[model samples]
Target: MPSLATRHEGHVLVIEMQRPLLKNALSRALQHELVSAWQELEGNDDLWIAVLHGVGGVFSVGHDVPELARGEGDEADPEPVTGLFPLELSRPVIAAVEGPCYGLGFELALACDLRIAAEGARFGFPDQHLFTSHKVASVLLPHMASLGIGLDLLFTGKTLDARRAEEVRLVNKIVPEGQALAEGVAAARDMAQRFGSAEAFQKQAIWGFPGLPLSTALNLARRM
Candidate 1:
């Protein structure tokens, strides 16, 4: 079966991680496919938004440990694999999570502009107890949550369901199980209607300009 699948609907593209047997683990091939697919979407003027998800019961089981353990991942240099970083996307992307979204899976979702999870979905940085982790929660989770909250989850490696994630503002919405992707697509469609062809440029400005001061942002906004 294909490791990943992509379909375009209206102005939105949906990419599904399709390895149910591994619970959709982020294998090297899958990562390569994701990067290529996202790059295609980034280059397309007709695509306003993209929604990412996993098939079957889980969003992902994180990186393929067996592959990494066997030295099979696409590690070309000291930098993290290109597939693991979606920060280069020039357009808005949304993550529709269900079942378990853990470790690098959680980080991938965090990379998106919006995350909409299923009511039955689970989320966590469970790799803190594992030796192979990159310790993203130590740095990124605190920025996303209260310092106390970050410590609670990170130190314990505890998982939370959809409602808890929403309460913590980790996800934008929680819908019925089996409906996360649909809900996410609906949200993306709504955003597409609101932004039209300028959606990518707008996302680039908002996410790309936050590091700049107010005057810098004003100048950037004027250019936009």
Candidate 2:
């Protein structure tokens, strides 16, 4: 079976990680499949939003440990632009996290526009135990929360439960266990119907303005 599967509900595309036995560990093939799915979502005019989740009650445990053990690594240098380092898709994407979201998985969720985490969900960078650096999370987490909190997670390699994740504003919403996917899809549908094209521009501004100087950001906002 494919490592990733995708289906569409009206304008909301649902992308699921299919490697349940591995707790949805992201192998190189799965990463490529995710990128392809995002590319398809971006190219389809009918699809205005997306929900990314994992099957079998797990979002993802992170990169494939076996692959890393074999020295295959996550992916080659200069990773694909689509899913690596948060590509600028015209439409927004939401992450529905159920179980453990660690390492690369945490980075993936952080790349999404919003996150809906289940009660049983946990977030962390366990790979830090191996002294490995997470390229995306290192940069994204601080922006999502305070620098102190982000560094705490990174340096300690500890986890945050669903409530803590929400407290820190890492997740937009929290639902009962097994309801994250449904809630995420419903939220995506609501946004698709209400946001229209303006949401894309708004998202662009949200992502772009953070890195700009105050005067430049204000000028850009004025133009928007």
Candidate 3:
């Protein structure tokens, strides 16, 4: 079976991570598949929203540590595999997480525009212990969660469960185990149909013009 699977369910494009044996870790093959899948979805007009999740019990337990440990794949910059999705995609992504989202795995969820987790889902960042730093988490965590919480997660290497994540507003919602993908896809479909392309366009405009001042941003918003 393909390590990653993509299918269109009406306006929603569901991307499922299918490496159940390894806790859905990001293998080299899976990484390439995700980039290709997302690129195809971005080019297709039939799809408006993408919902990302994993098969088996976990969303992702992060990188394939054994693979990395064995030096089995091409290595370049230490940036996480999630960086494969360039910031220019011009599409909104929602992540449905279960089990453990650790290291780069949690960063992938953070990269999404919205994240929904199953009850008891776990999140953590342990780059320091790995003798490397998480560039994405270091740069983007403060923007998503409180500075204190972000620091604690990044620096202390503690895991946060769904309830703690919800209390901190890190996850949009939490559902029963095995229901995160369904709930997340439902939310994505609703947002896509109800808001249409205007919301997507607006998000692109804002990210595309981040250097603009407040007055300039307002002017751009008016034009949109």
Candidate 4:
């Protein structure tokens, strides 16, 4: 079966991770497919936003341990793996998370411009407790939460429930279980319609504001 799927609902592209048996693990194939989906979002004028989701009851369990343990998944990717780092796309993407979102799964959601998680969802990085991880979370966690919070999660490899994720701003909003997709899609649709004129500019400006000094950021915004 295909590892990923994409469909459009009006201007919102819905990207689904389809490897339910593996808890939607990030296989190399899936990662490549995701890049294609993002590229489609970037190139298609009719597509204004994207909503990323997982199948089954779970979001993802990060890397497919079994595949890696077997010394597989070594194929070099043409582009940077999508969820492991913040992807640069002209259009905004929202994560609709449910169940466990761990390791790269958490990082993927963090990469999104916004996240809407189901009430029973979980978030964490297990690589600290196991082998070395992709470590992209090191760059993103601090951006989303306090240094202490980021360190605590990174060092302990512990999991956070949706409520705690919300408190730490890991997720933008929490919805009833099974409603994250609806909420995410609705939010994407609203943003697409209301901000389509300058959506790309707004995304670039907001994401760029983080690491820059206030003066530099202001100048950058002026240029944008």
Candidate 5:
């Protein structure tokens, strides 16, 4: 079976991580599938938005350590820019998170435009314990939450439950366990039907104009 699967509910494309046995670990094969899925979504004009979720109760346990230990795949070949990561998507993508979302999993959610985490969801960056750093989380976490909160998670490798995550603005909404996917799909459909292309453009402005000078950013916004 494929590690990733994509289906459509009206205009919303639902991308599910299917590797439940491994807690939906992001292996190189899965990353390649994700890239292909994003490329398909980008090319399909009928698809308005996307929702990312995982099978089983867990969202993702992060990277496949065993696979890495075996030296099976090239970690840097495909790269994040190839749509293996969330930030590359121009269209809006919502993350429906449940169970543990750590390391690469946490970074995936951080890259999404919106996040709806279940009550039992856990978010953290445990990679620090392994003396590793998360590139996306390091830059995006502070922007999503706060400098202090971001630093705390990175330095301590501690997890925050959904409620705490919501308090820090890391989660846009928190639903009961097993309801995140439904809520996320509903939200995506709402935005797809009501907002149309405006959501995409707004996301572009929010993510793209961040590091630019005030005048340059404003100029770009005006053009958009």
Candidate 6:
């Protein structure tokens, strides 16, 4: 079966990561599949938004270290793990996370415009090791939560449970365990019905964040 799967519910496209037995690890093949899915979400005008989750009650444990080491099938080239999606997708995504969201999994969640994490879910940055890079997390975490928390999590490889994640605004909200998908899809469907391309337009302004000058950011929002 494909590592990643996609389906549509009205204008909301749902992307599911399959690999429960392996804790939905992000192997090289799976990473490519995610990029493809994001591209589809971007190019398909009918797809307004996306909800990303994993099977078997877990978002993702992390990257498949062994696969990353040996490389996958032949030529053996590994790209820097730049999170799961493009730098900026025109369409927004929602991460419905449960269980352990670590390493690449945490990056995937952070990449989403909003995140819905199930109760008991765990979040962690990858250990500070030669094989892993947390560039995406390093950039986003400080802004998402706090600079001190980001430094602590990244440097110490500490993990946070869903309550703490929500408190820090790492996750948009926390739902009952096993309800992340249902809640996330329902929320997406509601937003899809109420909003249109305006969501993506607003995202451009939000993504600019602390970098873009206030006047410039205002112009972008106004233009959108």
Per TM-score, the best of the predicted structures is: 2
- For model 3, how does the per-residue alpha-carbon lDDT over 1-224 read when each residue is reduced to its tens digit? 68999988888889999999899988777887888878877888877888999999798877777777776437433455554553556778889998898887787888777889998799987545575566777766776677899899977889999999988888989999989999988998898888676245455776655456889888888898
Superposed on all Cα atoms, the candidates' RMSDs to the truth, in angstroms, are 2.7, 2.2, 2.4, 2.5, 2.3, 2.3
lDDT of 3: 0.80
Q: What TM-score does structure 3 among the candidates reach? A: 0.89
Name the best candidate (by lDDT).
5
Residue-level error in angstroms, candidate 5, position 181? 0.3
Model 2 lDDT, full chain set: 0.84
Candidate 1: count of backbone clashes, pairs at least 3 residues apart or interchain: 0
Q: Which stretches in model 5 have alpha-carbon errors above 4 Å?
A: 73-81, 127-129, 197-201, 213-215
The CA-based lDDT of model 6 is what?
0.82
Runs off by more than 4 Å, candidate 3:
72-78, 81-83, 126-128, 198-201, 208-213
Worst 10 residues of 4 by lDDT: 71-80
Which whole-number lDDT from 0 to 100 does residue 141 have in model 3?
73
Looking at model 3, which ten-residue stretch has the lowest summed lDDT?
A: 72-81
What's the TM-score of every candidate structure? Answer: 0.87, 0.92, 0.89, 0.91, 0.91, 0.90
Ranking by lDDT: 5, 2, 6, 4, 3, 1
Q: Per-residue alpha-carbon lDDT of model 5 for 1-224, expressed as tens digits?
A: 68999998888889999999999988888888988888878888888789999989899988777776675348633233256676766688999998999888888888888999999999997665445457888898888899999999988989999999999999999999999999999999899878776345466667887768999989997998
Q: Please give the distance, in angstroms, between residue 159's alpha carbon in candidate 6 and its true position after superposition.
A: 0.3
| lDDT for each candidate structure | 0.79, 0.84, 0.80, 0.81, 0.85, 0.82
Candidate 6 clashes between residue pairs 3 or more apart in a chain or in different chains = none
Name the better of 3 and 5 by lDDT: 5
Ten residues in a row with the worst lDDT in model 6? 74-83
- Residues 4-112, model 2: lDDT tens digits: 9999998899999999999998877888888889888878888888899999999998877676667443454224234543438777889999999988888899989
Predicted candidate 1 versus true structure: per-residue lDDT over 106-128, tens digit per residue: 87887788889998888886766
Tens-digit per-residue lDDT, 154-187, candidate 4: 8887889999999998889999999988899999
